[model samples]
Target: MIDAIKTFLVKIKDQGHVLPLIHQADIQVNLHCDQQIIQLNIKNGGILFLQNLDGQQVKYEISGSPTAMKQLFEGTERLRVLEQQGQLKASTPLRTTLLLESIFFLTKAQNS
Candidate 1:
């Protein structure tokens, strides 16, 4: 699962359209799937995936079961929809939530 997440982020990083957005933004996210936690640091025009939080301040924490996470990573589910269905939970401001949704949508489009 962590490998999949890393690969997904690598794809996003390589995307020309997404690169500009990523370069201009600094975001930190903690993804919790079941008992596993993966921290995503998006800053300085690069993305880093870490298994340990290392006391970094997190801007958002998104959590769900492994099944829910798999659905999301597979582009079979949207973050908003999963949250609405109680399959996932995200702690973030509205703006951040929208940003994440957009990122996921863009990734899905790329896969298509």
Candidate 2:
């Protein structure tokens, strides 16, 4: 899953759209699925995926149940809608939240 996500991000980045959406901000974000957390660290126009928290500071964290997470990853349910309905919890400023949402939405692997 992590390798797939890395590939997805790389593909998205190579397509030339992801970086502009980020607008050159270095950020660390987390997506929590059940008891697992996947960290996305964006720095110097590159992205890294980490499966452990390791106490690193996270700029944003979005969490949901495993089913809800599947929905998000599959694009069956949008993050904004889930967040609005309290199906998912997020910690970050609205701008950052939106950024994270867009990033996730764009990098979702097909048939994932």
Q: In terms of TM-score, how similar is model 1 to the real structure?
A: 0.81
Q: What TM-scores do the predictions have?
A: 0.81, 0.74
| Global lDDT of each candidate | 0.75, 0.71
lDDT of 2 at 4: 47
lDDT of 1 by residue, 1-112 (tens): 6756755776775567766656766888899986778887778777777886666767689998887776676556788899999999999787777776766666653355
Stretches > 4 Å off in candidate 1: 54-59, 109-112
Instruction: Please give the distance, in angstroms, between residue 52's alpha carbon in candidate 1 and its true position after superposition.
Output: 2.6
lDDT of 2 by residue, 1-112 (tens): 4544655665665546667776686888798876778987777767777876687767688887766665565445677888888888888788877776776677664544
Q: Give the top-scoring candidate (TM-score).
A: 1
Q: Residue 51: error of model 2 in Å?
A: 1.8
Please state the error at residue 60 of candidate 1 in Å: 2.2
